[model samples]
Target: MSASRYQDLVAKVDAKAKEFHERYAAQLQCKKGCSSCCQPGLTVFSVERLAIREWLNERPDLIEKLKAQPGNPKACSFLDDEGACQIYPVRPIICRTQGLPLSFKVNERTERDVCPLNFEKDDVLALPTDGVLNLDLLNTLLVLVDQVEGGSEAGQRFALNVDEVTRT
Candidate 1:
């Protein structure tokens, strides 16, 4: 699986996220070392998993650093003791979008959400529609990218979470 397509998607996501963060800086409490949203059980597309693996492979120092730290079962394995992500530069798309306003459909109903720490001073529904990321669309794009990257192969998909990424 290749990461070129996934990296393209990441670029788009990062642009959108940057715009939202800039526009909502005052309302967002997200900052360095804040990992309330970095929880366990978060899975990535095969493209993303491959990307993480490739990134780590290129950085043996980071691998050693991650190994040196004590992993917390309660938190994401990539999270450091200081709550910073050990693989921040190559983090998955979902991680890139955390703390941003997101909209997705569930049971034929549109659901919107944000990090509770954010938008506390304003109503989520009151924000401009363009201000929120279309999570469904993002996920669809990610899946397509994954499929193109050979993630459709048996057992190579995103069945494992970040913890397994560390182990394997």
Candidate 2:
């Protein structure tokens, strides 16, 4: 896909992410400068890799600094010296949903976890509403990526990993 198309997709995803954040902000007490999730050993998807590479290409010095960090396990290529995402604007959907009251099924049982900061709050409650998050927006972006590779999910995943892309 062209850079314009990628930009459009990123913009749409970012907008949807902001909307999601606003809708659930009261339930999530994730304050700024909380780098709990920035700890090493995180596995990022291909989309995140592509976005980070794009960010790095625009800032070679940042890339050099990231590579020069001592004892860096290279866990998350997106992390800079300050332990912040280099491409927060176009981060993946999972990153956007990191600290939310999300329900996921496992072994036919529903589970929930509040953000650490909100854990002690009693007034905060998980709304019974379903499908409030705009996950379809993320799916749509992935579909657009797949279409670029003749409708192959694997190809889209590969592109996100930056392994098959020349730009990375």
Candidate 3:
């Protein structure tokens, strides 16, 4: 039952992201081919990995396509050569929030962040609270949801190798 909460959270975030992307379409430089943020060696929490596995199980073709590709070493393994995500629908929260204005804390100080290519020279801090995604809050909620799903266990917390998703 708690596992479903994760989906709810994802739904909320996805809606917010979609709305923001639409309202600020001109400000956002994020396009389908843009993948500067899709760095290699990214790891997801166990709950997120479970979501990915479940999503792939429903679409074995994507799994086979992922397996056939000689993954890019410089970018995420799930990214195709053209820089599109193979698992966009079930991408991690971090991936979903990418290229958006995000507020997070660093050393107890609040900082504003956005993709360098996006909203250039515009002060993200000045944007209303609703305009920016509260990353800290989002992360906390995800951790709590993960805990409820039994993902807080020492070894089950995170998948060290994201590639493991393709094997099964």
Candidate 4:
């Protein structure tokens, strides 16, 4: 995709993210330093892999820093030792939806997980009234990626080895 187009999508995604945060701020108490979701063994989609690789390619020094880090296996390539995304402005949809009350399909069944902090505090009651949590913005970004590279090809191709990329 063209850089201008990517920038537009990034802008929209960032706006949606800010709106999401505003809509959920009262119900979510997940402050900084909480890295519950930044665990090991998370498999990102090929598009995300590509985006991170592109980001790293532009910053060779950061790649070297990541390689030198200890015990950083299979985590999101964008995550730093401080447990924050290096490219927060362009983080993937899944990361963007971390604390929302959203639903997803698994084996033909819809399941939900209220953010642990929200669930524990009886904040689930407020989520329903917070308006629709549509993921269309994210889906649109993915579609754009697919258009740039054929969908099937993009889905199957993994550009970087997570372990090798993370090794110092």
Q: Please tell me which predicted candidate would have the highest TM-score against the true structure.
A: 1
Strongest candidate by lDDT: 3
Residue pairs clashing in model 2 are 46-160, 46-161
- Which residue segments of model 2 deviate by more than 4 Å? 1-13, 71-83, 122-125, 131-168
Which digits, one per residue and each the tens of the lDDT, describe model 4 over residues 102-146?
Answer: 554568664556668754765443445334344444565666764
Between candidates 1 and 3, name the one with more favorable lDDT: 3
Rank ordering of all candidates by TM-score, starting from the highest:
1, 3, 4, 2
Error of 3 at 141 (Å): 0.4
- Poorest 10 consecutive residues of model 1 by lDDT? 154-163
lDDT of 2 by residue, 1-168 (tens): 246545566666566557757776665556454546544454444544555566667777755665566544543445556666655665555666666555555586655554576536643334554434434445666556545532222344432222232243
lDDT (0-100) at residue 45 of candidate 1?
Answer: 66
Which portions of model 4 show Cα errors greater than 4 Å?
4-10, 72-78, 106-109, 123-126, 129-144, 150-153, 157-168
Residue 80 in candidate 3, Cα distance off native in Å: 1.2
The models' CA-based lDDT, in order, is 0.80, 0.52, 0.81, 0.57
Clashing residue pairs in candidate 4, if any? 67-167, 67-168, 68-168
- Per-model TM against the reference: 0.89, 0.62, 0.87, 0.69
TM-score of 3: 0.87
Candidate 3: tens digits of C-alpha lDDT, residues 1-168: 234988999999999999999988988999887999998877777778878877788887877777788856778888877898878888889899999999999999989999999998688889898899999999899888777763534125444233576444
Who is ahead in TM-score, 1 or 4? 1
